[model samples]
Target: MPTAHAPGTTPITGVTIDAVLAGRLVRPLFQPIVDLSTRTVVGVEALARGPAGSALEFPDRLFAAAGAAGRLGELDMLCFERALEGAMAAPVAPPLLFANGEPAVMDQPLSPRLMELFASRPSFRAILEYTERALPSVPGSLLRLAGQIQLGGNGVALDDVGVDPMSLAFLPVLEPEVIKLDMSLLRDPHATHSRTVCAVVRGEARRTGALVIAEGIETEDDLVTAREMGAQWGQGWLFGRPGPLDGAGHRYDRAAAAAVRASRPGFHQPDGTPFEVASARAPRLPGTAEGIAAALDRVRHIAASDDAAVVVASTDDLPVSLYELAGQARSTIVLDRPVPGEFAVAVIGPGYGHAVCFRSTGGPELVMVDDLPTVAAVSRVLLNRHTRG
Candidate 1:
C-alpha cells in the first residue's frame, strides 16, 4: 500500500475518497469463519477493498486516504453497504455476515441503502465487529450505538482482542456476543500475555456465553492452540482467504445464524441523572467531603492507570486533583456548577463503574454506587450532558 502521501507532498485530499464513494468502487470480499468442532462454515466476515488496480486497492491505503481526507465515516458506511450487497447477491450466502465497523463511524445513522437492504432481507442477520483500538476514546458512543444495534435484532462483536491489554478491561463494557482473538494469541499461546488473554476471554465467555473465534490459523498446530484457548470458531488462511463469496461453496446454516441473532445483549439506553440511576440500583450512604475526596482519588487512580477510564464530575470549584485526573484520563469533563443532587462524580472504565452523589436536601449525605450498569448509566448521562453542552 502507498503511503498517505510522500514526504513534503500535500495530504491525500477528499476528492479521491469522494470519487470512490460516488463510483461505488469498494470491492467487498468474504472470509469464512468456521466452527472448529464441526469444521463447517458458520459465518463470513466481510473485508473491504478499494477499486481494482488502483493505488488504494488495499484497505490500509483506502482507509488511510479516507482518514486523511476526513471522510472516514462516509467511506466506512459505503464499505458496509457494498458488503451487504455482495452477500445479498451471493448464490449461497453464509448463515451470518460479520461486518467491521470503525468506532468514529458507528454513531452515524444507518445509510438509507443499508436500511433498505435490511428491510428487503429480514432474514439477513449481521454481527457488527468493532476493534478495541479507538473504543476507549468513544466508549459512551459505542455503548449507545450497540444498544441500538441490539434493539434492531442484530449482534455486537469485539474484534482483535489481545492486541491491546486495556481491551481486557473493556470486555464488560462491551459485553460483546462474539469475541475475536487476535492472531498473535494463537501463534504464541504459551506467552504470558497470551495466557492472560486466554484466561480473561474464557472467563468472559463462560459468564456471558459469548462465542470465541480465533484468527490467524495457518497451521494444524494453530488450530490445536485455538481450541486449547477455548475458541469455538476459527478464521484465517487455514480455512480460506477472503475472496468472492460465490466460489466458496458455503451452505447457509439457518440454525447457527439464528443463534447469532439470539446472542444480542438486550441493552437499553440508560436514563436519569447519575445519582438517580445509581441510587435506584444501590442505597445511598451518608458521607462527608473527605469521603467524596477519597472516592475521587480512586477515580484518579483508575484514570491514571491503563484502564482507559473516562471521568466526569460536576463541582462548583475545580480542585488540583480534578485537573490531575483530567490530565491522566482518556477523557475528562469537569462541570463548573453546583453539583447535582444525584451525583458529583462518575467514572466509567473497562470492568468498572463508580459514582458519588450528594443528597440534594441533606447536609453532605452522599450516594456512592459501584454497580456496573448503574455506573455505565451514570457515565452515559454525564457524557450526554457534556456532548449536548
Candidate 2:
C-alpha cells in the first residue's frame, strides 16, 4: 500500500518526455459504479497511474506531467490503449469502456489507433469518454473522428458534462451516444427541487438524445441522488468498485467491502425511488413500440372494455387528459422481452393516477397514442434501458 504523499513530495519539476515513460509507467486501476437499483457493478473507469518512481501517479498529476512534457496527446493515447486492453482482460466484461479523450488527440488522426485496437478484439465495444473540461478547438475534425469511431460499432461519450455550459454547447454538436454525469455533481445534497443544477442536467439530457450515465458515485446517497435526478445509468463505489483488468481487487483502494459497509442496503429513498436493486434476474428485453401496444390492447380486450373503456397504450404511452409523474416521482420499469410469447395484459401506469389496467393475454396487444409531447416523453424513457450490451 502506498501512503499519501505530503505536500511537494515527488515533484515532476523537470522530467523529460523519455524520462516519463522510461520506467514501469501507466498503472491502471478500477473504480466501481453501481446501477442505482441493482447494487451491481456496472462498469469501471480505468484510471491511469504514472511511472513507478515518478511523482505523477494520480490522474491529475499524471496529466499535468504529460502536459508539461508536451506529450499530452501521447499520454491520452497510452491511457486509451491501456483501458481497452485492461477492460478486455477483466473478469467482468463491461460493454461500455470509458477511455478518456482530449481535444488534442481529436486534432490528430485517431481512427487508425482505434481501428487497430478493435481489430484485435472484435467483440469489444468501447466509448471514448470526453469531459466538458476537454473541448476541441478544431470542432470539424474532432466531430469527424468521433463520428468515424462510432460508425465502427464503438461509441463516443461526453463524460461528466453535468450541466456545464461547455457541455451544453458540446451536446448540440457532439451528440454523443452516451452523456455521462459526474456522480459527484449529481450527489450534491443541495439538489433540493427541480430548480437545482442536477435537475437542469436531467432536463437537458433528454433533449440531447443521448443516454445519461452517472459517474463518481461513492455511496447509497449518491445512487439515490442519481435516480432522483433522472439518471438512467451511473457508476460509483456502491455499485462495484474497480478492480484489476484480470479480476483482482483494486490495488490502491478497497471499494467492495467499504461500499458493503457504507451502503444502507435499502432501495427506497424518502423520494420513493426503488434504488440499488436489480430485477430478480436479467429482465426480458422491452418490447418494441408496436409490441408494447399489442400487449396493452390484449389487456383491455380481456377486461371487456371498449378501447375507451380501458385504454391500451404503448410503453411509449403517457399522460393524456390526466397527470403524469414528474421530477422524483417518476418510476421507469425497464423490461427486456425475453422468452417471447405472450405479455400479461395490464395497464402499467404511474401510481396515484386514474390510469386504466386491462388484463388479458393473446390479442391485438397494443393501441397507439398519437401526441407529440407524450410521444417525446415516452421516447425518452423507452429509449433508456439497462442493456449494457
Per-residue lDDT over 101-174 for candidate 2, one digit per residue giving the tens place of the 0 to 100 score: 76655566654664587778644456677676444243444445565565556667777664443454335334
**Per-model TM values vs. the true structure:** 0.84, 0.55
Q: lDDT tens string, model 1, 161-279?
A: 99886677567657788999999888788998899888988987876778899999898888988999999989989889999998888865566776652744445355666566667
Q: Evaluate model 2: give its lDDT.
A: 0.47
**Candidate 2 C-alpha error for residue 345, in Å:** 51
The number of the candidate with the highest lDDT is 1
Clashes of each: 0, 28
- TM-score top scorer: 1
Clashes in predicted model 2: 28
Q: How far in Å is the alpha carbon of 205 misplaced in model 2? A: 4.4
- The 0-to-1 C-alpha lDDT of every candidate, in the order given, reads 0.75, 0.47
